[model samples]
Target: MPSSAAWLMALLLNLMLAISTVFIGSCLSESPSKVRLVGGAHRCEGRVEVERNGQWGTVCDDGWDLNDVAVVCRELSCGAAIKARSGSSYKPPAPQEQKVLIRDFNCRGMEDTLSQCEQDGHVYNCPHTKDAGAQCEKSPSKVQLVGGAHRCEGRVEVERNGQWGTVCDDGWDLNDVAVVCRELSCGAAIKARSGTSYKPPAPEEQKVLIRDFNCKGMEDTLSQCEQDGHVYNCQHTEDAGAQCENPDIDSPFIPENVRLVDGPGRCQGRVEVLHQLEWSSVCKAGWNLQASKVACRQLGCGRALLTHACCNKTTQGKGPIWASQMSCAGQEANLRDCPFRSLEKNCTHDEDAWVECEDPFELKLVGGDNPCSGRLEVLHQGTWGSVCDDGWGEKEDQVVCKQLGCGKPLVPSSKARKSYGPGAGRVWLDDVVCSGEEQSLESCRHRFWGYHDCTHKEDVAVICSESIPRL
Candidate 1:
């Protein structure tokens, strides 16, 4: 008979064998079995195909459904399965392409990959025309305002799987409205209404596809909001609706379609403008600091520090040159409002315009005896520059003092210049005006940045009543 130690050794060996079996089985299950979606609008939604024996072939739709598709969507890391389509819904496979090589998927809908699902057999039971297709929520969806007085007001309908459907108003509110307004380039959300408040064009016909949307009012699209996927409990009568104020022609909100791409950050990049749903570059001809200023302000950036011409750098762009011969006087509210010539084919992308804007303005008191008293220097375009005293007064001084948390302005109008002395560098402002109630110096009316006519002798300075921490 074997000793007790030998019995224990056998038990340990069995335990080691069990763990090794599981590790090997898991690794084998995850081995490469390539699957792809083909012949659809985008990568995420298409006819299903799988690779077998070094050849690619379609999947038979004999038993395809949302449950089977859920495995495929999970394998691709797509959010969730929106729909499972077969036959005529997707494009037919080419004549010379391989026939269906996979069929009869019995997925529990939580498998890591389609290959892990139980299949009837490795056999072809259908023709290429009967291939399966899937649409996932990860695909880009389009949103539009319908049945309203104008483009910016009405019933909110979203497009998914190439079909238009209404959103359920179960939890819709101003937060959702804000996202819709920003997406449509409308200024801001005026009101959020329900289907009961604003009757859509046709109620019973529209399908309710989305429900319980949770939005933070910052997303660029409605589909980005967290929501239940394809809720069937909602009726068109419960559709979401909104009223948005159209941005004024000169408002920066109207030109929110402009963006900076392929740069270090949002404020510096090759400039692009959305025209007819396509992004096009602006030609460098006649592009200058004035045009750059409007682009910067419209993008919620600070003053323009350098244009492509000013920096002598080039970033070639693709597609159409939308505008040329820009002639801005540096005060236009939006880039579109500036006078510019139409497209010129002769211009190439190498002449595409770019801009480096000053980061959001940073204020500091320099050359003073203490933290709260000094020449008023502003950090712009990566440099500390002086503000002009051409229109300096207690009103302007009060704003500067409050912004720095320096208690209050100490210099009375009678003794405005207490000899903090003039500052050197670019004169960033001139002819300033303030109403004493503004929060910051930038909010006050002033000449365009870097357009001052005064010299350093007129540089502005101030003395505050309290000393604050150093910046």
Candidate 2:
């Protein structure tokens, strides 16, 4: 028989061998097979899955945020993360040994790989139905799609600081409207509505976001378009909204067309409707701000700048008198979408209706003790709101100074430390991309006129030379 001491030594050797085998197995399993995006429309987006034990599985959406999504995007070199999707919208691989390999992820949005993220190993509370999804993009968008009747038509809203807010309709136009439609893979914008009218109650915390969006009509998302960058200059009434027409649906509703003609800008012109293949003028009988708003937004001109009582101006081109009056809730995308009298009532050339949408963005300064320095604000019709400090620098500041006749700027600051304080109203404009060669600040490239992601605390302030009085 073996000695007791020999038996103890033999037991220790077997234990050591067992530990070594397990460690080596773990090491082998960790590498080669990696995290990947699956079940998405594109390779860069889809349900998040990890391979383990030769089986692919999903991750729980619990505590899943942009950080976790970012790590996966970086690992695959698929650009930046556009969204962190929730629910099992993307179906996972079936009947796997492990349906929930990665229980949960706690990444800091800086991890190089998904394995580096903290996970809730041996998850018992999570289920496969809670699987998470992600969308990585070559050009990530700050915009999101939510609460639409179908996923394409709904009140226009934006995300800021992790909170969702409605967009102001002050300067929303066709190009701006089109971007939101295309972002959701929807058809062109058939209607641009205002958040203030016939709309559901927004979250108490819901802010009135981006107002004036200037897209070339081809920008991928609203964030890619030019904006004003301040919130204090707009209201919920100006909250931008849109309803997209699904391209997949053939023969969409094409309403009678109305065009603004003979005005200085695209926004300001006499109203004309298409009838019998020949455009005719709309009568000014019942023309109101509500009706004019629809025309301005539908025409891609923005909100109604001014409704000319030009019942006296003659039509410029070859359009005859058409409708008597048009009634709109100020939310319709098309003027013809509204209730109108198509009966060709008594309307002469002198009774032509004209509407001028906002043009040459109106800007101002507020919250400053002196006119030279303070919070920035812009005028979109009646409401007055402030501008954001994003992308605000020397070049843009110089233009503001020149516009206000403040002379040279002493210190152009993104934060309004020296100013009175944050102003009241919606924060508009963000990521203003200025070329530095533009004469005016408004002329400098910017995001939608009223869209912003910052608070009034981040309002821009400029200290001018005070414009010394020369005797």
Candidate 3:
């Protein structure tokens, strides 16, 4: 054995060597490390690992927080903090040798990298080796509708987070469809459809994934839906859509006793029968003698009349009354009997000049089988709709009698019971109080007109005679 002093010195040396080794190992294991960002826009991710004795080692992410995410964002030059998660992809076999826990980190919320974040220590109790990962992304501020026809049969696209995407038609109901119609201001929702009617064929990538869609009944835009948590399986054919209709209007009746005038030259005049309103032009189309004769007779003019080709001057070279040519068979009754074009033209010399007619004596309808033969037929609505005889009581008939300058009501049938045909769509006339002050039949109050379910035979008719004389 060596002397006590020498033995003591040797022991001390060994002890110092062991301590130095530990210090070196610790320094080697806890050096600064680098991490790389992965993933892409709106969602970002990254991993970090330290170099120990030329070997890469990962730190546990237990200590990662908003501050650390901020540092990562600053380092990467990403705008701001979004989110962070902790867990391990790798775990050590030895319990004590597990990755160090990232207990605490402090950073300015706007920082870009973990390296810039202030940390409590290198050693951590992070549960797994792959625990430190994060995601940072930009957010969208606005949403809007993009393309397609906004009418009844069109597709609607949306823009969000700086990108455009189609809306999934899944779970689309009336409430949702209603909103879309309202947005376009296209009346009400007539139909709601799924399984795309207007999608592009063969798309390279998927378009949209709508999870939950809640729409207010009147919203016209699909983006107005409040989406829930569901991955929308919007395939090309699964895009949603809708259809709409136009609303009904109040005044849609035509006038009576309208006639066309065959002027002195080819540029003759034509007129339309509107409500006691006034006479307007039929404009001009292909004008032939037969059609002119029909128009003249319909206006109570006796026979075939002359024909005129009204030119640019009459149409003023504008509007729907552009150029027109008409053809008619004498058998037809009205000016509309002719088929014509809707453009304007210059009068040609070959075309006959104006047409004239001999007015027929006013003939009233009698209670016999030929009731409608000599009486005028008035049109209501777009079609030849009807009016009810609701107000045709004695007082009403008395007024009609005086207006026609004839006798009293020989027979007043309220429901068209005596004759035959479909009843009017709906009886619009009720309690019609006609006074002798009114001039024409149209000047009566209860003459409201609308769609009627009447056939030709049931049309309202009147009969008048000079006196109780002959029959």
Q: Which stretches of candidate 1 lie over 4 Å from their true place?
A: 1-296, 299-359, 413-416, 469-471
lDDT top scorer:
1
Q: Write the per-residue lDDT of candidate 2 for residues 1-471, one digit (tens) a residue.
A: 899999999999999999999878766555314666665655568878776544456787888999999988877656688889964676433223346766678999998778776677566777767788899884344554443444456677775654456776766777787888766656668777765543353533356666567788876667778886577766555666677774322221223456777876556788776653467766677577888887777654556867755643344444566655655667654554455444445766676677878654667666565777766777665577776665567766777778778887777565444555777777666655444455556555455556566887776667676753432
Model 3 error, position 388 (Å):
9.5
lDDT of 3 by residue, 167-279 (tens): 66667777876765554334567676653564332132425646447886744245545875355444657666565542211122222234444444222344333323344
Is 2 or 3 the stronger prediction by TM-score? 2
Candidate 3 C-alpha error for residue 304, in Å: 4.5
Best candidate per TM-score, number?
Answer: 2
Query: Which lDDT tens digits does candidate 1 get at residues 130-216?
Result: 778888765366677865545677888886764466788888999999988866646679898875555324334346878878999
Show model 2 residue runs off by greater than 4 Å. 1-183, 188-269, 272-290, 296-337, 340-349, 356-363, 367-369, 378-385, 394-428, 432-451, 455-457, 463-471
Report the Cα RMSD per candidate: 25.7, 19.8, 32.1
TM-score of each: 0.29, 0.36, 0.24
Against the reference, the lDDT scores of all candidates come to: 0.71, 0.65, 0.45
| Angstrom error at residue 96, model 2 | 52
Q: Name the regions of candidate 3 deviating beyond 4 angstroms.
A: 1-286, 293-322, 327-391, 394-399, 407-471
